[model samples]
Target chain A: MIDIQLSERQEKIIDIVKANQPITSEEIAKRLSFTRATIRPDLAILTMSGILDARPKVGYFYSGREAMSFFTNQINSMKVSDIKSLPIVVDEQTTLYDAIVTLFLEDVGSIYVTSEGFLTGVVSRKDFLKNSIGGVDLNKIPVGVIMTRMPNIVTITPEDSIIDAAVKIMEHQVDSLPVIEETVINNKHGYKVIGKISKTNIVRVFVDLCKNN
Target chain B: MIDIQLSERQEKIIDIVKANQPITSEEIAKRLSFTRATIRPDLAILTMSGILDARPKVGYFYSGREAMSFFTNQINSMKVSDIKSLPIVVDEQTTLYDAIVTLFLEDVGSIYVTSEGFLTGVVSRKDFLKNSIGGVDLNKIPVGVIMTRMPNIVTITPEDSIIDAAVKIMEHQVDSLPVIEETVINNKHGYKVIGKISKTNIVRVFVDLCKNN
Candidate 1:
């Protein structure tokens, strides 16, 4: 199946049509503050993309039941492995100062702490904010001192569904979750960090569902 | 017409069914690390909510089309007036230092800057981050100096569709947008801040659509 990217204006136009089917291009343009001529090409592209349909008198309507079915099928069948993204990892020895820089540099909400390639702990932006409130010397403090330790870290396996991941995110009130794989170590269970699922990933899925459908 | 709040577990159950329709309660329980008995009550609640349907041999399937239609109708017909939330406004004369505290205290990504009750400018977390990088004297700098000025501001009116608000949010790459109403002031156009919309609001709508549908 082809996945096409839509401009914000085009997406807005679709929203308008979904709300008001048989809406004219002139109406869409009026709502968006663009001239009718400027938006004509957008209408043409949307129609060509199978997102909209038009007629001599009926104007434009959504032509997306097929797309919707495609999306529904994917979401229903997709596992966490299909959509989990890479997690930004840091060493336990990394200083809190470095972690802050890494956070901003990576532009992520949290960082995973790894020791010898095993999942250890997790740190988030909120965690840093809390620590910073006391005015501690970040340069001397290692991130490990403040991370949420293992056994306390909420994780998901790749075998889990995307729905499970979404639930964990909302329940934990965290921005993301580490996708882990359960391993037996000395007859005890341990989790190995494999990937991550974030709020942004969920949003992307929703947006793509709208675009592809 | 009714919006029922769903427990997190109930929401996850719906997600599981969406991913695996015609799924038995036993299979769902197995996936969720819960006993069949523990989940039966949740399943009963879901089925009762009209979010799910079941047959003698077919197990459970989603009955969310009606819910989806309800959500679609809301998004289609709801105006900013219907969903707009309160904006966190601060005077333009406030110090950058105070603004930083307000942002973290309020747990908001952006803040509105008003001058004598008139919307003047806007500041965001990113703006503060960029300014703080050089370790400038935040106490001496007024927020008005660092805020985005009007004519450059992206705004929505209370009459705009919720879809229109969503598009403006994604287009501007901002976490939130101010809902404003234009007014005639001293023979010039001025905007009166009425409310706000954020990415969280859009996500809430999506989540509610899933829950209701």
Candidate 2:
């Protein structure tokens, strides 16, 4: 993680930039009740950090990409609770048709396959493709028939950082993470999903934070 | 548009906030080679504009969502280039299976469809689903056969704001935007596929921009 250390003064300057970027340093000094001469040095430090862009007469602006990197560098600070939405799971007994409809309506790319109420496997859009583009029976074939089963699953706790979660997505080459309460990912046992986190959700959180940066 | 006027001091504070947030007012004073006493009031004024958030000890931060809202508030300062990226489209003659696979591999939910290299229609997973779900010939059928024909599509340009792109996604119930070079979409004459933009992309961009803060 890049420990972006900002002195109290530097921090205050960043706050000001975020508050009114694509602005001028002279104007900023007036608003913060500081003098242009005082804020100038601080602005220089920020520019050196590649955190802010300065236009002589026009003023300064924050680079959105740069600002977001500062926070994500330490995504370990994020908790599973930070991503609170739960995912709707499907039973292995569920049919292909149901899975398709569910996936579309929920706007998710995959679903956990469970038996009773525990996760047994995972089925994705790719899994559905193997059988079609043909009309087929969703009821006859169990979701477990195509799902990538336990022991091969990747799960995260509510306490995991956003960076940790992002790594899993990249490594697994999967679109989403099934947040589990308890994990014994083996065929003999089962994975119980409590919630879900997708690449989209992670991105959403960062974007929201940047907006407020 | 959110025409909140900025005092010179307020502008400086905003600049600083953008440079580095999760910062304290005391830090701002030191960096500018000034005293914290001088920066507090200015910070307070900017915060009152609803552009920055100041937590007594935590310092201040920027507000991006509010900025996005302002972009959407009117056409005055709003430009298509703001939210616009390049465009990406596929040939109508392309097979359905190939398109679906491309969408999956690219991690994108939709792709623009065209004929003779001109915009003609749009094919989304949902559009494919109603027919693709049943056992059918994704290989044999041309994507043009299933895509949403041109002139009926909703799109935006490079000058538009992020909010405009977002609103289009929500309104069309579509997940992405295929930035088109041509003002008019012709099903038979597809435009050059420059880049792709999506809600997911927006989220990712934001998360990336504010990772540090």
- In each prediction, how many residue pairs overlap at the backbone (N, C-alpha, C within less than 3 A)? 2, 85
What does candidate 2's lDDT look like per residue over A146-202, in tens digits?
Answer: 789887888787878766676677567676888877645454455578888876676
- TM-score of predicted chain A against the true chain A, for each candidate: 0.63, 0.61
Residue-wise lDDT of candidate 1 within B1-213, one digit each (tens)?
222345688789989999999999889999999988677656755664467898777799988644332334445787878878889999999998898889888877689998877899999776776566445688899999999998788899999887777766766666678999878776767888999887666665555555443
DockQ of each: 0.02, 0.12
lDDT of 2 by residue, B155-192 (tens): 66665566566556655756677666653445433454
Judge candidate 2 at residue B69 and give its lDDT.
27
Candidate 2, TM-score vs. the true structure?
A: 0.57
lDDT of predicted model 1: 0.75
